[model samples]
Target: MVEGKGEAYLLIDVGHVLTHAAYIARVEGTARLAAVAEVTTTTAAEGGLLDGVRRATANLELLVGRQILDRAGEVRQPRDGDGHGVDGVVVTASLAPLLRVALVGLTCDFSLASAVRAATLPYVSLERTVSLEGPGDAWDAEDLEALVQEPPEVLVIVGGADGGPVAPIREMGETLSTAYSLLAASQRPAVVFAGNERACRPLEATFAGVVEVSAVANVRPSPEKENLGGLQGELAHLFYKRLGRSEGLRQLGTWAGSALRHDLDALARTLRFVACRHGLARGVLGVDAGGNGCRVLWVRPRGPALNWAAPFGLGSGLGALRQRRDPTAVVRWMCHPISWAEAWDRLSNIEVRPGGVPETEEDWDLQQAALREALGATWQGAVRAWAGYAEGQAVGEADMIVARGTSFTHARTPGQAALMLLDALQPTGLVRLALDWANLLPGLSGLAERDAQAAVQVYDNDALLELGTLVAPRGVLRPGSRALRVRLTVAGEERAELDVPAGSIRRLPLGVNERGRLELYPARGLDVGLGRRGRGGVVEVRGGALGIIIDARGRPLGLPKDEEARRAALEAWQREIEQA
Candidate 1:
């Protein structure tokens, strides 16, 4: 960037596992951050983090900017190389040799799977996956033998994070330590631990010099929470550092540029952006709730945000919610005539307590109670506890509330806030929007990251929602029926329209990083993507235990239930992949 008359900036973010300091350069129209050297922090004080980072920069010192976290976002613009002592907190990048990797995970759901996705993302050559159904103690000498059968380039570890990735930390540590001791010193596989942040330090000390070691943040911070932006970026950086030796990145790194985004934070920001930018009112609420915690952000016209990341998630806090009493009492949209027994069973199934499922109605009742307890107890409680922490200036009443998390994500794709709205059931005006699909404003935001033109390419009115006029009054009331048509024209040529219904969902054919405007259909069973019932794009429905009204709008929807149908749907989506 020094060549582009630009600047190099470094960002340090401290999460559960790793503290990453990215060396980024921005000059003229170029930006790139070395993908390699993403290191995991084991020690709380990180005695060597800053030194290591500064040393790595020597190979390429044109870097002009430095960024680091002070736990609460301290460290503002410090002088280069001189920052080591300025703040007692600094981190450097660590490089491990080669590229062999073992994906150790707790569950195959979000966190573990997200980790695997991140590893495979850079298209890194993977070695194996290590899984433990129970505690790491369950894995004996034979297990260790299997993990070390061949000297892996890196050992990427992950497991249950809801309760903290600790139990297996000690067990996995002992096992990996044994493996490390047995391996030849020079050929020892470097350990790149990216699981429970709590395990990094102990594991590092346990296998000191036993093997090459580094750590990253938890792949999936919480069950429903995914910090893939950090994981994938760091993984790529590490991959480039070790495997590419700078050769792999070349033009790619230059193209990728130096600026980066924290995946969770970016996603939250994107959703908030969607709430404000896409809508006409200039105010939107987007929240992501998971097993461990929830992230809530409110965006209104002309200002900062009312945003925060809560360390409490629905699943992790279910037990706590029960203690608070009545999860449904406050949530009114759930008036689907669900019995206490039914609600209990639903919660029980979701909790997936190590070894149990509801068998009897009483068990079901217990489960519902647990679910209520869990939902009410957690980060949602944090919402009440930390009310308006995310509120910003120029904010009146919340225009629309967008939320996604395990509790919300698992319940309904786009149903959360709607459900809340329904429960709140104001007898007057109501605001409508597309708050479905894992709350993926970040997916669009990612478009901005991956390609600015593409980001602008997808940013049309329909691609975004311009808040319609509504004066909401407090009182529960379900509307009868209404329809509206929205046409989103981009660059005065390409256009996407939503024949959206006031009370129904219509799925659209999504092309890579593309956005569409939603307009209501004049008739039912009409195709939106294909335009005018051309047998191409029509709203499809797959009802879940969550909501019934079926209101959503997005392209390339998430996973399916039926095996054959899901397979066929996936095959069909290949078209979108090709189209994208």
Candidate 2:
């Protein structure tokens, strides 16, 4: 407690594998991150989530030399006479199990597909989807029974564009009401109506006493407009309510005085703020991969689009990588050959002990390859969702890509981190890379609501670790052809020029705090974000520990077909970045 100018914040994020806490103290009218600590998340422990929170806070207390909790193990609020306590506590968690969901819609391509996109959000898993076309549509009684047996936490009903046909939606509502009447009061899942506005009131009436009914704005308002934020916000609210019922959350909520914030949403909003602050036109892309899932949030001027894949992450969700992508995708990135059996064994070990880290050199290689595959799957899913929801619009190129989670934050070096991002996301054009090393994005987000200037101060001064800027062309040149010829002039420093060959990545030494002027000349048939082949442009570039990296690897990043040749190529690229 710093006596009133601003408030101190103790932000805690309860993840599946780890419970992380950050302490941000306002000093001289600016928010400064004091310390960060993490411990194993113990959701099943007898003490509940409070136990983990207390442990993490205690660790922070040791680092900051201040007491955050009282003798009875309660968060000390206010000054506490000696000014040893914090002003307020902010909490966010991603430890809750995903809700089982049943999707019901009139059309598979429109309403149902949009519902599928909504279900992809964090904390909800699509358990089943039933499409009811019209009055003539036949639904199997046994299938309905099976769905009821599974007992979805929520049933989403969506269909019929605005001012579109009404009779079919009415029929579908009646059918759903009949199905709801068959289940006992305790077994019925909550119903969320996000279809035609006209049908919303009637649908709520249809299920009024039978079950809980929540009517939100239609997910797909028409063929061209998609209003998902209203529905997504509602779902997030409901999820927070359910999460509050947990023993761990119940205790924390009582102490924090506010409901726990959704970690992914908090991070997304923070990234949006950062991008807007910098006046970035291309917007920001964020990837948070952890034991439970990978959450991708892309925010542009148009709006923010999010996709949460519950089963595609580096830890417990690794199995989804194999399911959603080619089984050999991880192996393809590896220089040394690893048989499927060997890969599976390594993956199985990771799945069982998700918090484990790589020890040996072989282990590190396997982890990096596996992480790349997970990130790729996540990026592809997000892009597909953006295309569908944004009216055939695509994420052209992100101005900033922020990589979060343990895999990226704990990498051995900035070089390794840059290479992993390049290999996984394969971003085109010129882009800036940063990592959430302290896991402070959530904390900054929480603070933004209370003190925006403080939030931005901490972010720009203490939070994001700039991993340098990358310039990668979209098109490919002939093998060994000049992909990009560039002249880099560091501000108040010397200037240098280099010709980078196709299918290679080169790094120029530019330390952090130095800005450079770059004149880019791509070869014929190549595009470096700007249109037209061989077109040149001048742009300002920022520096990080790894400096400026130029990746000429063909879009889609080609690899040698022969085993030995592929190994040699992978080794050569690794040396250029990781071993340099």
The candidate that wins on lDDT is 2
Q: Candidate 2 — which residues are off by over 4 angstroms?
A: 1-7, 97-152, 158-168, 184-187, 194-205, 216-233, 321-329, 390-393, 492-494, 578-580
- lDDT (C-alpha, whole model) for all candidates: 0.42, 0.79
**Model 2 C-alpha lDDT versus the unseen true structure:** 0.79
Best by TM-score: 2
Count of clashing pairs, candidate 2:
0
Candidate 2 residue-wise lDDT, 1-580, digit = tens: 2323355778888887888999888777677998999997876544677788889999999998889888988877764556588877778777767677888888788878877776656456667888866466767677677666676888888988887777767777777778778888888888888999888777777776788678888999897887776667777877878877887677776766655776776777787787788877787778787886777777665554454454677777877776754757788888767986788689878987888768888788888888888888777776764664554434636888888888888899878888888888889888999999888897677776766777788898889899888898888777788998988888655567889999888888777878998889999878887777778999999988778888998887878889898888888888888532
- The stretch of ten residues in a row with the least summed lDDT in candidate 2 is 388-397
lDDT of 1 by residue, 1-580 (tens): 1211223333333222233333433334454433223233333254443333333333223333233333332333332464421111112111222245677665666556677666643124456765665663366455567777776666777765735847667676777787678767876766667777877777788787687567777777776777656566666666655433433223212222332333444544555565556563546655544444444555555443444443333444344343445544322212233555465455545444422334664443333333333333333443553343334422323556554433333332232333333322221222433343322244345445434443343343113322122212221112223333444333344344544433333333333333333223333332332333322322322122221122321112223354455445433432222221
